[model samples]
Target: MRMKHLAIVAALVLGLTSSAFAGQKIKIAGSTTILPIMQRVVEAYMKANPDVEIAVSGGGSSNGIKALLDGTTDIAMASRTMKDKEIKMAAEKGMNPKQVVIALDAVIPIVNKSNPVNDLTIDQLQAIYAGKVTNWKEVGGKDEGIVVVSRDTSSGTYETWSHFVMGKTRVFPGALLQASSGAVLQAVAKNPRAISYDGIGYVDNSVKPLTVNGVEGNATTAKDKSFPVARTLQVYVDGSVSGAAKGLIDFILSPEGQNIVEEAGFIKL
Candidate 1:
């Protein structure tokens, strides 16, 4: 009789544990830079597991980090790597931040379709954006002045270029700064002599990407590590995360989720 009672207790405990897990839901939030790719993963995962409620938000990387620290988000999707200040802030709050590189992306240099230039060496790109090579004629295009376009100063993509390409130099004056990658692509598409940078996933036939240091934007260059401006897309979470957050991370790291990331034009890690 004691053995039967023990079996009954075990079954009851398992039932309650399963019920608790099924009852949970989680919401994730993060930067707009990875929205297109992240959205694809979230929607598909939700469909497969209807019990899991995955909500996404886009308020820039800073806002995402803020949400994570405030307990408003389960995960923070950041385009750029985490900053030292952000990491230190989490530590002070007893929140351990962990990162996962979901995929790789490129910071593509784009020019208007009508523009005759096909590629720009790194030096030429810097000079054009620094107001040194003002005219397109200097770069084998029209005689008109080059219109420099850019993302907002707060943008991760902007920060990447400033550090890697511009090397802390100020951009050329009269440059137009948009707030998002989509906005940057749109602005470049509209301007005949405009040049801008955006995440490579945003690149299409609408605008052409110029080579940096003679390395083209292709799969071979990416695999061989010749692509100069590529960066990793990161997902961050509090170290104590469990239950729903843990499950969500598993889903993202799983082959199924990575497949979605790859299909969305990112290099799945």
Candidate 2:
């Protein structure tokens, strides 16, 4: 009787261990813009719930959407809304992408600190990027030729800029394109004449952020919609989210998760 009792206890322990190890794991991939906020929130979530596992990555927003349609990632991060074409493509693949707005963001234009230009009107910005105004002197800056830096076409930041600043016009062909927001910051900071745009969270002492039509890019301006370059930051889930995926999403929308967003230098929703 003693030996049979010990065997039952051992079996119970093994079953509990198996169940704990079987907890759901979620994978999130996309927008470099949303990477920092997601990282901090997920780190907190994992600590609070030890059984859940989450993986996060950044390869621009478009790639994140592609991952969702391909059935590779549980969540897709985006700085801009899904284009109609992307929605259609996902439908063709039988995948429905649902967006959850997690925060607000303002795309701030940045220039090297040494540059004297402080603000730019909408038309002036358009002319400069359209290749019509090639020299800084035209815009009350130095006499040197302007060094245009921009995000790659695949980037959601680029799409936002193109819509608001460029009026859907293409950036000048001569502009240099960077792969990520960090890359854009680095390129602009290193070159005195270089001008580029990045999320407000990415703004730091390395580069000077320019005012758009005299309105600064910040939480206040973004929330009031006074900032011309503001947009929503989102995470796209496949159909109805459940399990670990839903847990993470719920935590993000909670007050605790929104606090993480603010702590990461973004405007919390």
Candidate 3:
């Protein structure tokens, strides 16, 4: 009878473990620029499919990809493409990352709303960020020192800016480095002499967007590839993800999800 009881208890333990494993919640992380959009998408998804559960958070594009590689997150949101080194590392770990494009974006320059400067040529922007142009007057603005605010190295926005805007140069050491897009927005909004760059979605009445080479960073311009800094917003997954994770990815690519992307101030794919 003692042996019979032991068998029953083992069966119960196995059942409980299987149940818990099957019910694990889907986790999404990375890219503060994509966090707001994912939050809204998650809300809509959960409301429609009440049985599923998902958790979303932001660190930055690099951290998100790292989370995926470490098996901590099911989805990794990124504003920039994964670097070759990252891909090689994932391959070495036997994880093949699949990229999915969800939306389009423009990494546009921004300044305090009170600033008079409206447009900047790419050459002038390079000079300012390279620490060559110290005063706003050099770029057609007031004669005040330009306070440069930049996203930190881990940020996908910063990657985009470095590749497209800074080119062969780098942001000067004196520039203030912000951790997230929201932080960058707030830093520029609070300081009249400050200038920064962020995904177009983060722009609000609190800060003014600057045109590049006389072309604006709007949906039309981004879609047509005329926006110089425009890039595809994407997510990365390891191997073939199914169940709740795949469901969430499908929702993001669906028409309804794309609509939410546009509503969140990004261009729909």
User: What lDDT tens digits, residue by residue, belong to model 1 across residues 1-269?
Assistant: 99999999999886664454565677677667788888898787666556667788776666777788888988988888778998888889999888888778878899999888887887788887788889999988899988899877666787777777788678866788887788889998998989999876788889878888778866566656688777888888888568866766777789998887778877777
Model 2 clashes, total count: 0
TM-score to true structure, per model: 0.87, 0.91, 0.91
lDDT by residue for model 3 (173-207), tens: 99999999999999999999999998988898899
Error of model 1, residue 15, in angstroms: 12
In model 2, state the lDDT of residue 29.
92
Candidate 3 clash pair list: none
> How accurate locally, in lDDT, is each candidate?
0.80, 0.91, 0.91
For model 3 the local lDDT of residue 199 reads 93
How big is the positional error of residue 69 in model 2, measured in Å on the Cα after superposition? 0.7
The residue pairs in collision within model 1 are: none
Query: How many pairs in model 3 have backbone atoms within 3 A of each other, for residues 3 or more apart or on separate chains, i.e. clashes?
Result: 0
Candidate 1 vs candidate 3, lDDT winner: 3
Candidate 1, run of 10 with poorest lDDT: 15-24
